[model samples]
Target: MDNQLLLSLTEKYGSPLYVYNADKIISQYNRITEAFSSVKNLKLNYAVKANSNISVLKLFNKLSSGIDTVSIQEVQLGLEAGFYPENIIYTPNGVSLQEIEQVANLGVQINIDNISILEQFGHHYPNIPVCVRINPHIMAGGNHKISVGHIDSKFGISIHQVPHIKRVVENTKMHINGIHMHTGSDILDIDVFLAATEILFNTAKEFPQIDFIDFGSGFKVPYKEGDISTNIEELGEKLSKRFNTFCKEFGKDLTLMFEPGKFLVSEAGYFLTHVNVVKQTTSTVFASVDSGFNHLIRPMLYDSYHHIHNISNPNGRERYYSVVGYICETDTFGSNRRISEIREGDVLCFNNAGAYCYTMASNYNSRYRPAEVLLYNGNDYLIRKQETFNDLIKNQVIIDLD
Candidate 1:
């Protein structure tokens, strides 16, 4: 987006804002589907936990995409966004059986990843079909924090425990309709995913009534220029052939599904924040912004990299500086990064802020959450307003301190 237009947006709405380009999102969604168009039955489920914005969710629905929900509230949000209950899949981690049962009552597809929960839910609801999340014990992304399919990870039932799962299903007479596996996020190797897919294919053989296999999405997007990303085209070509063969061998056509969150919207999002102060010490120059981790915590929480540029001075001489936030504790976005000359009140735009950014925002230190905007057809529309003091205390009980 034009720097002047972004500056105008900050002036018109407020600083510390999230701006998304709907066109970018559409293009990304089309790209993924086109890549996998060869598949007979392909299902793309937008991971609602990524951005959960009703507008974003509605946009996905308009794209004819299914929803991947991890909570009952997300299932409700999907329904509110105009998705049929049958089109939504619930894949929550470590939630209660009551919550699962509640969402199941709404008729959304349920995915069970734990052996104990599988037995319990199956025993209680024997007729309801469930998807099984398997842990292939494959290490992906190399980051322990993001890797979920390793042996020690708690995100899925272990492949070694397949006998246990089969025993539970047989004992409870539960119907298994789908087999699923998610290795981790920021996946760069298609071979690792294919290996995990092989595990899922093998597991699906145990459940003769299965209708689909969800290879949970972690397809990496380029965080910066020249950064290695997932090769979706090649993956589609290879996986499509394998999936078709599997379907043929299994004597039925099955749905191939993925739940992509970051891939569809990360590039579509831009986080805009105004420079509040320029602090210079003997050793460091800190470019402090009006927002903190309360607004975007990826840097502090995940050691993630978000490419920041000085939109205000695109042509200015680049200099290395430390970008920090106004939070009370240590909050550093990047250390010793070269950016264009920054000035007080200048707008710095952070790329790749679409997924897991706003949805993870908090009210720490009583800081109001930033506003959100959607840019469509070269026009800016304010989708969410900046929080006020009332929002900070809306749920608090101000008990009398006599």
Candidate 2:
């Protein structure tokens, strides 16, 4: 993105803003589709949990993409964005039976992970075709917090419990239409992901009525310059062949589905904040910005690295400074990072702020959320407006204390 354009956006929309490039998003969506082009049947369900903005969902919908929703609200968003119930898969964890029934009532595909709920749902809605989430017990993600398919994780039905799942299906005559597994996020090793595929295939064999296999996506994107990312082209070549062969052996043409969130939208986002003050402490220099964990929490929450640049002084002499936010507590984004010299009022842009950033934002310290802009075809469109004091107190019931 051009620094001048971001500067203009910050000036027009104010600091602590988020800007998304629509072209990048389209290209990313294309990248995934192109990678699996060899497969006879491919379904890329845009994981709505990553970025549930209506415009973003609509963009995916415009591309004829399906939606993978983790909550009932996401399903609603997908539907409001013009996606049919058949195009949306509701896969949630640790939810109640009522919630599953609620989603099932909507006629969308329901994916049950717990055996208890599976049995209950199977009995209640045996005719409703369902998907099953399996925990392969593989530690595949970069961080334990994001990883949910390990032996001790609580995201999917354990592979050992396949017998129990089979028994439930037999008891209720439930139709199993899909087998699914998501190891975690920020996955780098193709072999590690492929290992989970084998487990999914074995689990699929238990259910002769399955029609699709969903390998939940965790493809890593480049965070910094020259950073390593998942090689989709390579994975495509290998997995497409295996999936085609598997389908042939199973005597059914199955849909190869992937629910990718970060891979589709992470790189297209840029969070722009202006440096409020350049404090030179005795120990370390802090470039305090107008935002904090309230606006972007990945740095403090997951220790994730978001590259920061001094867009206002891009060609100035470089210096090492610790970037901090204005929250009362410690909210350090980066420590001892080298960037072009930053000055008061200089704009600092954080790269890779699309996925899991705004969705996790909160009103901590009673701070208003930043505004969002979408850049499409050389034009900027304001999607979300910055919050006001009215927004802060709208939900609170205040009593007169006089």
Candidate 3:
């Protein structure tokens, strides 16, 4: 995005705001679609947990991409965003059978991860089609916290439990329609993903009634310039060939589904915060901002790196400064980072902030969350309004102790 545009947004909406480029999101989705165009039956399910904003979901819905949700509320949001029931997939991990049943009632595809809930749900609703989430035991992702398919991970059922899954299916007469596996996020290794896919394909053979194989997505996106991202074109070509060959061998044509969240929206987002103070400590200089972990917590939570830019002073000389926040804790966004010299009240933009940033935000320290804007079709729309003080205590009740 141009500096003038971001500057205008910062001036209009105030600082500590989230700006998403809808065009960039569409471009990313189109890139994936083009890469996998050779595949006859393919579905891209946008993982709603990444960014559950209804406007964002509506944009994907317009693109004909299916929605992948982790909760019944998200399923409702997807429906509210105009996605058809059959186009949404509810893939919750460690959730209750009641929640699964609630989502199933929404008419969306259900993906069960554990055996206990799977057996119970199947016993109760044998005719409903369901998908099984398997743990491939593959260690992949940018960090351990983001990785979910490791041997000890609680995200998916153990592959060794295939027999038990079969038992549940046979005893309950459940219709198992799909097999799914998600290695992790920020995965750069294509071979690792392919290996997981092979495992999923082999497991799918056990269920001849299956109509699809969901190779859950973790395609990495560049957080900074020169940073490596997943080679989707290469991955699409290779995986498509293998998938088609497998279908021919199995004598059936089935859909290849992927639930991509971060890969589609991360780079399209920019978090803009204004410098509140320039504090000089004993040994280092800190450029404190008006936002904290309550607004963007990727750095504090996962030690994630987000490329920082001084959009307010892009032409200024670069220097090293520790970017901190005003929260009551040691909330550091970046430490000793090189950026255009920052001045008090100058705005800083955090790159790759679209996916987990706002969705994971909280009202910690009683701070109001920032607003959101969408840059689409050469126009800026206020997708969300900034919270007020009343929003902080909207749900709290006071007792009269007089």
TM-score for each model = 0.98, 0.99, 0.99
Query: Residue 311 in model 2: shift from native, Å?
Result: 0.6
Better of 1 and 3 by TM-score: 3
- Candidate 1 vs candidate 2: the TM-score winner is 2
Ranking by lDDT: 3, 2, 1
| Candidate 2 local lDDT, 1-402, one digit each (tens) | 999999999999997999999899999989988989999999999999888889989889999999999999999999899999999999999999998888888989999899999998889888999999999999998878999899999899999999999899899998998999999999999999999999999889888888899999999999999998999999999999999999999999999999999999999999999899999989888999999999999999899999999999999999999999999999999999999999999999999988999999999999999999999878899989999999999999999999
**Lowest lDDT 10-mer window, candidate 2?**
98-107
**Residue-by-residue lDDT tens digits, candidate 3, 217-336:** 999999888899999999999999999999998789999999999999999999999998998989888999999999999999999999999998999999999999989999999999
Model 3: lDDT of residue 49: 92
Given candidate 3, what's the lDDT at residue 155?
A: 93
Order by TM-score, highest first: 3, 2, 1
How many steric overlaps does candidate 3 have?
Answer: 0
